[model samples]
Target: MEEEKYIGYIKYEGNLVEDGLMDARKQAQALLGFDSALRHFIGKRAPDFRNLDFEIPVRIRKGSWEALIPETVGGWVQGGLGIVATAYFTKAAQKMAEKDFSDFGITDLFKHAISAIQWFVRIGKHMGDTAIRSFENVQFLEGNTLVAIPNDSGEYLYVPKKMLDLYTSCNPKILEKIAENIEEGRELTIGTIVNGKVEEVAIYAEEKGIFCEEEAEPEEDVLFPELVHGDDVVLEGEVTRENKTSNSMGFKYEEHILTAYPESGSVVRYKPLLFLKCRLYGTVSRLDEKGSIAARRPKLYVSHLEPLESDREEDDLFR
Candidate 1:
């Protein structure tokens, strides 16, 4: 079956003021009002705006062209012209606002509506130099190709398919592991290479684990790591600590912590096993906030421990 696709949108709030003139408290209230009103209008929850402050010059540039209609026309004709002018100006304002907010990483159906209208207007006006200039100004708008995906934190992460492709290309091994785990029906988490180490971005599991509730379906052709979690894999690391204790019921248990320092050190907790001076292999069952495999309280459980030979030469060789 073909997978369903969606074009996501984010909510944006901005003060219509010049730079260095905003009252932060007032702006905050306005933003809150705008968000609330927008939610009521759309009948859905409002998405967050990018935290950066935005400033747009409040100047109105006048065009060289003058109205051709004669002033001798009756008030009724003038009234009709007034209505037309107001409608067009309102539309233009909306278009400009949408473009500005989308630039700051916020989008919504209303913004999309304005964007679509502007797109059509630009295409329709292609024969004119004015349209050409307008098109040029908006040609780089991200809404032309990008879509938003809300992560576990209720914050939308804009992921363009192109961006995802670039990330996957950087590490094909991670993608392969993800595919294998998907086929096996395991929980999935999104991770990326940070400083040559895998870092967790999103986690998706049903057992009240970390991260937000999964709402959207995963894209079939491209997997978003933030929307999915879990994959089986082997990791090699040094055993850092080991402990054995008995529960209140007198049931004995054992715990071991391993630290792997490939490019950077990552700690992993696993069940008791034979001690080896060399690194041991295990699957990543959970990850911490830093994207390293979680140790003390792991969501990604490591299993099937086995030791690997050390790369360092024995001291006896120098003797």
Candidate 2:
């Protein structure tokens, strides 16, 4: 696998109030000053990219403020309020003409950038002169989840395994930490990179000394016309045409033809059952696609094999 790289920028928008005073241009300039400090910090910390230059061009308009990030350093602006931030991938990050760097990984870089800024803010708070305001919206751009789907071309689109790893690992950790450490008068917005864009997933806010938010339920009417890659489905059917093989890596894999009986009709699908420790009569999520001559019949990379309740007999029934 090739190493993926990215160019990250943290855009901060807000006002600087000194002695209950607010000046648009002055606030923008203050942010520009902080940008200088940010550059220095990035130079001292991320020595690997010391050559990267950052431009902090300040823009001021009617109730509109913008600060450009030109260097690699992440720093805090004294008397500045954060509204939003975004990061874009550099040319160096692209691996191939078709393949882009993983969004999950870019989000990781964004978190690191924010942490660097927060560190600077904490230090300034100790000095009692700098006050950093929390951002209402924070996002890392150029983030995406790579998904594969079959088209007319008899080739398979492969979702990189690393993408899945990053999504499953990073999301939960970030959410848990935010939920545990969220302070009073602050809110945290959570989102994921979906199809090359940042999609807001959830928000955590402090209310009545507790973080409470409504959970989003999956849409019931959202059904795919054809089974595509990365579709979560429940397959309750009989296993047929089963086969097993071992790869050069000595990994044993299994595949079987599943015939499912839905209320509308019966559908036949080929799926993989990799080291599943249960009987196959439950829900599974599609992972990858293996194109076939029959466009409708594609091999599926599936996981999360959950056995049906009927398949699990109680102690009395077993006896």
lDDT on C-alpha atoms for all candidate structures = 0.28, 0.30
Runs with alpha carbons beyond 4 Å of true place in candidate 1: 1-296, 299-319
Model 1's TM-score against the true structure? 0.16
The lDDT, on a scale of 0 to 1, for candidate 2 is 0.30
Query: What does the lDDT read for residue 176 in candidate 1?
Result: 25
lDDT of 2 by residue, 1-319 (tens): 9532222222222233112233455444445544544444444433433454433333322322223332222232211212222222343245324553354232343444434443332222222112212222223233544433232223333333333233222212222322332333323322223234543322223110122122322433323335553444544333322221111001111332332221221121122222223332222233325433323322333332343344343312211
lDDT at 298, model 1:
26
- Looking at candidate 2, the ten consecutive residues that score lowest on lDDT are 244-253
Off by over 4 Å in 2: 1-28, 54-111, 126-319
Residue 115 C-alpha lDDT in model 1: 30
What number of clashing residue pairs does each candidate have, in the order they appear?
16, 5
